[model samples]
Target: MRVLLVGAGGREHALAWKIAQSPLCEHLWIVPGNPGTATLGTNVDLAADDAAGIVGLATREQIDLVVVGPEAPLVEGLGEVCEAVDLAMFGPSSEAAQLEGSKAFAKMIMLEAGVPTAAAHTFDDPAAAIAFVEADQQAWVVKADGLAAGKGVIVPDDGNVAATISAIHELAATNAGTRLVLEEKLTGPEVSLLALCDGERAIPLIAAQDHKRIGDNDTGGNTGGMGSYAPAPILPYAEAQALVDVIFTPVLRTMAARQIPYRGVLYAGLMLTPNGVKVIEFNARFGDPETQALLPLLKSDLLELLHKVATSNLADVTIEWHDGAAVCVVLSAAGYPAKPRTGDVITGLDRLPSDVLSFQAGTATNAQGQLVTAGGRVLGITAVAPTLREARDKAYAATELVEFAGKYQRSDIAARGLAE
Candidate 1:
């Protein structure tokens, strides 16, 4: 099957690497892919959000399947664009994508579906948000209603409601007209579960734990993702299935009932709170660094699974995974999650182990034809092994091989899982 994969990030590179290995894939193309993806397939010079342009290319090329990798385009109606041409595409429609596009909308869905989540209130006025925070003594979470590239949610270090309000103000400065969602913060370990859906049926992938903070021991600011480890033993397969039964299934049914049947990945960011598994957020597409960590353990043909989901034949599909753990440590530019400095030359990629896969996120070929930094989160060093400890060790070791000026990575990825 000829495929056109969208986006240019570590997730796309991982998807490109995985899809290119499938024998069913006759040809692979990526829209505005990074340097790493360019090595895997034909990279088109088209922006991911250019809906008309993407559709024209897909139709003209007669692409068998268009696999969307980013949430931006998916939220902008890439699935509907494909539908217009009667082309097969793997992603949720724009209406269904509101689950990620708007936190308030997702909260409403959760409330309607009886999905367990934190109680929250949305505010368009900053003063009202601050007043709400001041009135509540409980620890709170302040989130930008719109996309902030994973840096929207702010949890204060002291868990002070006032501090959270301050964070909202800080976040709102650059994100003009920002709407805020303030919720009572829940305490727990978090897990990311990505499920493949075909309007009705859903197949869950192995649970992954993502380190959203930029520093070790979950300190510092939130980034796209600093690192991640898959098959989170904390949320085992049986428990994951229980989550699917109570959470994902109901949510899917609710969406179907609303006339927006979800078609692609349903990423549930869950918190294993004292009560039970409560949803942290919902993403219409695959989680980024989590995808880098989890895809390596996927033993089944990704192409076939994606096709099944897109074609609404997922009920008959059975997915398989390799028995092992996978880890990914993201190397980001200095001052990342803010104003990241780019254009530094990168080196040592050749030194990576055969088992390790270095997926590029923010990198480009400069006029000098040198691979250099082009974004905040640059490289994802991923490794899979028989044990989580081994996988974590290999991933960190691979990070040492890759060198660039001002490159930084979390010192402890999968540390909790390894300690366990």
Candidate 2:
């Protein structure tokens, strides 16, 4: 089968790598992929959001399946465009994608579907939002209703009501046509549960934990994702399946009842609170660094799994995973998550151990034909082993080999999983 995977990030590179390994994959193509993906398949020069270009390419190339790696294109209705052309695309439609596009919409769905989540209130007026924060005098998680590239939510310091109000004003002034969803702060270790949906039933994958903060020990602000580890000991596969019955099943039933069947990956950002497991947010597609970590442990054919989801035949497929752990450490450029410096030559590609996998994200070819940093998060170094400790050690060791000017990474990744 010919496959055309969308997006140009580390997640896309991971998907491309997995797809290329499938015996059924007769041909593979990536739209505007980075250097890492280029080594796996034919890298098309068209942008991922160019709906018309993607449709034309799929038609011309006779691509059997189109897998989207990011949420932006799906939120922009790329899946709808593919459907109009009678193309099989592995992403939810725009209406179904509202689960990620609009936080307010997701909150409403959770409330209506009897899904467990934090107490929240949506406010369109900045003054009203500020008044609410001031009256509560409690720390709140302020989130922009619309998409903000995984940096939309701001978790204020405990008892910092002033910071909460300030965040409200900042978001109100900057996010146009967007409201604010202020949620009561929930405490616990977070887990990511992503499942393949067939518009009727859902199959849960191994759970993962993502470190969102740029600095170590969970300091600093959130970027896309700094690092991640798979099969987070906190939520094993059996527990993850039980979560599916409670979290994913209700949401899927709600979506189907509303005549908007959800297809593709349904990612649940969960907080294992003392009270119980509560959802933090939902992502329509796969998580970034989490994908880099999880894909290496998957023993099943990725192309077949994705094709089944796209065609509503997921019920016939049973997923399988390796009996080990995986970890991903992200390498960032100078001053990442605020203002990242780019165009620095990278080295140590050839020095990575054969067991380690390097997935590129923000990279480009310079005039001298040298690979250089072109975005904040540069690359994801991943490794798998019999234990989380070994995987973490291998991944961090690989990070030392790769060098770029002002390169930054957290000293501690997968530490929580190791402790668990």
Using TM-score, give the best candidate's number.
Answer: 2
lDDT of 1 by residue, 27-103 (tens): 99999899999999999999999999988998888899999999989888888888988999999999999899888
In TM-score terms, candidate 2 sits at 0.98
lDDT against true structure, model 2: 0.93
Which lDDT tens digits does candidate 2 get at residues 1-420? 999999999999999999999999999999989988999999999998999999999999999999998888998999999999899999999999999999998998998889999999999888999898888888898999888888888898888999998888878876532699999899999999999999988999999999999989999988999999998999989999888778888999999999999999999999999999999999999999899999999999999999999999977677999999999999999989899999999999899999999999999999999999999999999999999999999999999999999999998999999888
Off by over 4 Å in 2: none
Please state the error at residue 247 of candidate 1 in Å.
0.9
RMSD of 2: 1.0
lDDT, candidate 1, at 281: 95
Q: How many clashes show up in model 1?
A: 0
